[model samples]
Target: MTAAPNTTKPSGQDSPSTDTAVLRALRRIRVPQTQRNRELFLLIFAFLVNGSAIALVQLGTMGAIDAAFLFYCGALIVLVLAMHIVLRLFARDADPFVLPIATILTGLGIAMIYRIDIAVELGGWDAYSTKQLAWAAIAIVGAIAIVILLRNYRVLFRYTYIFGLAGIVLLILPIIPGLGTDANADVWVSLGFFSFQPGELAKISLAIFFAGYLVRTRESLTAVGTRFLGMTWPRARELGPLLVIWLISLGIIVLQRDLGTGLLIFGMFVAMLYVATGKTSWVIIGVVLAAAGAFLASRVLPYVGGRFSNWLDAFNPEVIDRAGGSYQLVQGIFGLAQGGLVGTGLGQGRPYITPLSQSDYILASLGEELGLIGVFAILCLYMVFTSRGIRIGLAGQDDFGKLLATGLSFTIALQVFIMVGGVTRIIPLTGLTTPFLAAGGSSLVANWLIVALLLRISDAVRSRPRVVIG
Candidate 1:
């Protein structure tokens, strides 16, 4: 009645303007500046500590900064600066935890790589420290750019099929005529002066595809189908898709002759399926199928069969001396055993004795030089990393976020387990890189991208506004 007595309010009473609203919204958006600063500080500290330590060791050995040492130090400084700039430019909003972890691990990796390089130079194999520094610089730039540009991981779901197909093609491309190069353990693409492993990229893409696919299909995959002995099996149609993936994975193992990457990819799928569907039976089924495939592979594929045999007879008189198979493993065990409790000191041990010491056998090198204490530190870092990753997965608000985090975390866990287990004789040899610690361009870049994805997911999870619904 009577326009509610002009309850709208008198003159001079007004709400905030559009401009004010914009400023207020910006304030509410938490720019992640403080976290970024903390990461920057940590990166600087780690770089200084690691770089200075290297200099001190070199100085002690060669007695002061020689021309080669100066050149190396100058190059390293420039590269580190470049990488730092790249991180600031692209990953400004990334989760604080990722960059610091990356920095610490990268520092450790560089130190180890350089340590191996010095030994290799003395042995006439032409050490790769320079090239490794270059690769690390490029990887850091790429990681930052990816985190900045690809803010929404969900966009990957749109191109899941394309990514999956391309990934499969890449995994098998190593078997293609004139394209693949069998670098000791197999799985590499030789491009003249620069060789790269496509499986590194393929693994990440496939994990994305698997996560997106499994999350979408878990409902049907877990639904009760036909009952057998009081147990419900997935529908035939549902099983068909999984079987196809399994076959593809096995094909990678056989054709590419890379059991490590094959097992990694398969483990990713199985883990994601279990996480998405919450079905233990699916895991059991996947394991059984994997064992059956392994049996068949052992009998058929000579290379695979040899690997299993080598793993079995690792200490046998006949297998211990062969350079191609058991030599590295035997040397690795010897090195670790020599380290015992106190290690041989940083630059004192002969880690380069093992083939591919900077890459696949880096763990062995670490064990020899760092000893049990240093190796334990490395293990603790991984444990911290996994614990943080799992926290991110649990904190994520959406299904895709959860799956992505879980898949990434599980992938790292599996890689570490396979590598450490192989070196420690807990499992058969699998030539997988120790993430962040291994020396390979493709691996470094791929792993950095993984860290970026986790950072992005963590940012989303952390920034999400809570709401109450009745």
Candidate 2:
């Protein structure tokens, strides 16, 4: 009788021992309906916050709630609901907080920009607020398309080098003779009717290249290195990838006059390298290399040196009064001081006194209006967004997804640091738009696309198929 016992074990969850009773096979799924529900709830609050802020802006600045503004807000809210419905069907398991946080930040920026328009007495389609709204609409459409069409982001891995080349071409486009605008920084491309910053999209392409390349070459990077300063440094041969990226970054800084973007691109790679290798030495090497490049640039380029001087002696009478002086910097600082612990209450503050309030100085303008408490809230939103993004990367089952999610998320966080550091006088100022909160068509589109990518990644991480038997 004992010979009747079989000894084969089941590879799947359906073990023979469960044959005593009826085994009901059920597939367990998580975070589709629930994630979407959470997002919908958060979206309600976001809508309320944005609507209140806009209503208050009109009351404080125009002394009446314009019927048209209410209609406009209602239309935007409807558009957002449509987006939510689309996300539910497409990226059902995406991080719930990411979209809502972006929604609030963009709304608050528009509210502030609208108030500024009143202060400057600009109106109609010419106002930056109007243009920003149009851009936001276009960006949302682009984001939706990505989320829907790019069901499997892994396809991008196949075109790694192609993305890298595209990134190079984009970086170069803004420097081409006829295409580049006549701005102080050669970072924009003009196509007759509209202008764009190619660096914005270049970020996405380059990040993909970096993630894919590192995923394949991580073993080589981590395998062989020389010991130096109590740490393992990459061998001269292993250093090729890093050196190439560094040189390209330097070229951007020196040629395009885009110090922020150059820094953004290089810093992104350094962070990704650390993620790939799990070594502190790479970070140290990155800092050293960046400092060296910066010092060299300061010597070769007068503007770079001037930026450093402004950072150091912004209050100097000679520096403040110069043609391209620190007047704006000083004015922004005074605005922050005026904001105190609590801001001057929305549109009541004179943020127009600060130059470039709607763009580069948007944070200072917000600080002057909403105060320190508001600024901290905004920063906290960024922290949440970043944490969610990093969490998605950590939860990924594939190397490429892990590196890509983490790298892109780190880029957003790095950009925040760069912008905030400049505004608070923690670093030399360079032009980098605040994500989701600055008035730029290019930036808005890029930001939404980044959000879409993160959403896609998070969904992929959570929605892997599973089978169970009991």
Candidate 1 per-residue lDDT over residues 85-137, each given as its tens digit = 65456544455666666666766776777777776664222456666667776
Candidate 2: regions farther than 4 A off: 1-27, 466-470
Candidate 1 backbone collisions, by pair: none
Native-referenced Cα lDDT, model 1: 0.76
Each model's lDDT comes to 0.76, 0.90
True-vs-predicted CA distance for residue 252, candidate 2, Å: 0.7
- Predicted candidate 2 versus true structure: per-residue lDDT over 70-179, tens digit per residue: 67767777777888998888888888999999899999999999899989998899899988888988888888899999999999999999999999999999888899
Candidate number achieving the greatest TM-score relative to the actual structure: 2
Q: Please report how far candidate 1 places residue 129 from its true position, in Å.
A: 1.1
